[model samples]
Target: MKLKNIVISAVAALTLGSTLAEVGVGSKATVDAASINSTAQTYSYVGTSYLYKILKAAGITYNKFYKDNKITYRKGKPEGIVVHETADSGATAYNEAIFFNREWSNISAYVHAFVDDKQVIQMMTTKYGVWGAGAIANKRFIQVELAEVSTRAKFAKSVNNDAIYIARLLHQWNLKPNDAHYDGSGTIWSHYAVSKYLGGTDHTDPVGYFSKWGYTFSQFYQLIKYYYNLQGATTNTSSASSSSSKTSSSSKASSSSKASSSSKASSSSKTSASSSTSSNSTQAAKATVVKKTLKHNAYIYTSTGKRTKTLKRAGTTFTVTGTKTIKGRKYYHVGSNKYVVASNIDGTLRTLKHNAYVYDTVGFRKGTTVLKKGKRVRTYGGRVKIGKKYYYQTSVSTFVKAGNF
Candidate 1:
C-alpha cells in the first residue's frame, strides 16, 4: 500500500494550471497571457469606495478589474489569500487579465492577480468576489494565480513575486499571518486547501503543479508571513510622514508664504504703543465687522466698497460683516456696507477662477481639483441657507458656502 501511495504521488506531481473571473482558473487565453501585466496594464476597479481611489493613488492598478452589476455585491472582509494555479504552462499572466475583463469566457472564474517570472499583474480587486474558487471559498478569500512556467527557475521566480505581492496585500488589510491550515479561518491558503476546507470547489489544483518544483503550500505560507511582517512594520512609516506633513503645513502657515503683511499682528502703524489700549478699545467698539481670511491679496475697501490702505492677507484672517446682496450679486459685508465679493474669498471659488476648487462639502473632502478663475461669480441665486449664511448647490450632496465661496 505504501508503494502504491508513492507511485500515485509521483504520477500526480506533474501538473499545470488559469481566471479572467469567468474565463475560470484553468484555461487558455486568445492573447499572450505574458502581455497582460506588460505594455498597457489594466486599472479596472469597481465601486466608488475610497479604497479604489487609494489604490489608484498608490499606483496599484488593474486594467481588467470589473464588476457585474447583475451579481449582488457580496462584501467580505477578506481574511486571507486563496492561492490558485493556472494549469496551462503556456498561459501567461496578461492573458488572464483579458479573460477576466469579459463576460464571455469559457470558464466562469475570477482571481485577484496573476504572477509569472517577468511580472505580477492584478486582474481584479480585493473589493469584489470572483467565481474562481467554489462559492464558499470565493466568499472569504482573495484568489491569485501563480502561472506555471516551462522552466523551474522561472516558476521559482514567479512564486517569489507572489509571496512579495501577497504580503503587501496582507499589510494593506491590517491582517497578520494566519496559522490556521484550511480550517476555513487562516489568513492565506492554496486553492486546494480552501477547496478542501470550505468544500468550495471540486478541483484540487496547484497541488500537482507545486509538487513539481518540490514546493509546498506550507513553504509559501511561511514566505508570505515573512514578507508581511516586513511590510507591516514599514506601514507605520506613513504615519510618521503624515505627522511631518502637518508640521510643514503649519510652518508654511506661519511664514510669509501663506499670510500677508496686513494680517500680521502688531503691524499697526495706526495705533500708538503708549496708551494704545484705549485707542484699540475705541476702534474695536466702533467696528462691528466680522473677521475672515483673505482669499487673496486684495485691498480692503473703505465703507464705500472702495480700496482702503489695508490689503487683506491670504491665510491670515481679517474681517467681514454679515451677508448682503448688492446689484444682484452676492457679497459679504467686510465693514459696514463695505463689501467684498463672496467669490473673491482667499479659497473663495470665483466662477471660472484659475485653479479654484470645488469640494464635496462646505468643509471640503479629500482630493482637490482646480477650477478656472475666468468669470466672476456674482450670482445672488442660492438655495441652501444655514443660519445667516447661504450656500450654492454644487451638487445634490455637496455645497459651497457663500461666505467662503
Candidate 2:
C-alpha cells in the first residue's frame, strides 16, 4: 500500500493559565487517568475516558522542524485537522519525519506533522496545506499522522500528544472542534472520514487502528474537546476580567442612585453596558499588521523562543502583527503562536552578480524565470543546498545560485 503523507509553547503557558483560572471559576480539571480503575467502558465517550484524563495531566511537549515546502492552504488558512495513522505499526515519529522529508517529492506524499508516544513533531506549518490526502481535503484541512505503537502505555501517551497538539492548533487558528459528520461539514476529521466523505483517497486508517484499542473517533474527539475547552476557559477568564473592571467602574456611579429610582436605573445601566462593549470591539480593530523582509535564514519560533522551523531563504518577506522579547532576544510576532527573530531581517534587496537560473527545492529547474545579470531583486536569507550546490532562496519556491550574487 502506498503510505499516506500526513500531516505550542505560548500554548503551554495558556494551558497553565487556564488550569489556574479554572480554580477561580469553580471548574475542576479532570482527574488523572491512572487513578481510574480499568473497565471495558474506560475508553468510551459516556464519560471522560481514562486516556483523556491522563493526557490532560501529562501535558504535551512540542517540537518543530519545518520541511522545505511552503504550500499555503487554498483559502490561505486551514479550516480544521485530519487525523491519520501510519499503519506501519513500528515506526516512530522521528523516523517518519526523516523518511518523508527526503521522499515526499518522490512518493508525492507529505503531511503537516507526526505524533508518537513521546512528542509531537511538526514538520510543516499548519498555516499551509500538505499532499497527505486528496486534493480537496489537502486544500482545506491540516493533516496529522499518529505513529503506531505496541505497548498500551505508549499508545496512551501518543494519543495524549495527539489530542493536545490538535487542540492547541484548533485554538491557535480560532476554529472549533467538531466531529467529522456524514455531510462532511465538521472540523476534526479522520483519514477514513476524508476517504469516505471527501473522496481524495481510499485508505481507511485511524478508524481501524482505533478499533484495536476499543477506541472510537468520537472518543478521540472528546479528548480534543477536553483540551479545547480548557483553552476557551482561559480566554473567557481574560474577557471576564475586563468585563468585571467595567462593571465595577459603572457600579460606583450607580451607588448614589436613590433606592426609589433603582428600577429605572437598571434599564439605563443595561444600555450603557451594551455601548461599552461595542466601544471595546472598535478599539481592538486598531492592531497594526507589520511586514518585514528576512535578512538571513531565520527560524520561525514559538512564543517561548523554541524554534519551530527555519523560514524561507533570506530576503523573503513576512507580515507580522507585533514584536516581543523572548529570552532577551527580540522576535517578530507572526500570528498563530509563531515568532521570528527581529535581527534576521533588515530588508529584501539583492543585486545579481550574474545571470542565474531559479531552481526548485530539489534542484529541478522551476519554470523558466531567470534573473538577468546585474538585475536587482529581493532574495531571502540563508543558502539552500540542493545536491552539493547551494542557492539563495528568492521566494517560497524559487532559489538562485549564491555565486550569481
Clash number for each model: 42, 15
Q: What is the TM-score of each candidate against the true structure?
A: 0.43, 0.44
Q: What C-alpha lDDT, on a 0 to 100 scale, does residue 143 get in candidate 1?
A: 76
TM-score of 2: 0.44
Report residue 39 deviation for candidate 2 (angstroms). Answer: 11
Best by TM-score: 2
Cα lDDT tens digits, model 2, 30-135, are 2223211121112211111122233345573222223455666777789999998887768887777767755667777878778886546677557778777788
Off by over 4 Å in 2: 1-70, 235-405
lDDT at residue 239 of model 2 (Cα atoms): 26
lDDT of 1 at 402: 48
For candidate 1, the 10 contiguous residues with the lowest summed lDDT are: 243-252
Number of clashing residue pairs, candidate 2: 15
Residue ranges of candidate 1 with Cα displaced over 4 Å = 1-66, 69-75, 103-106, 179-184, 234-405
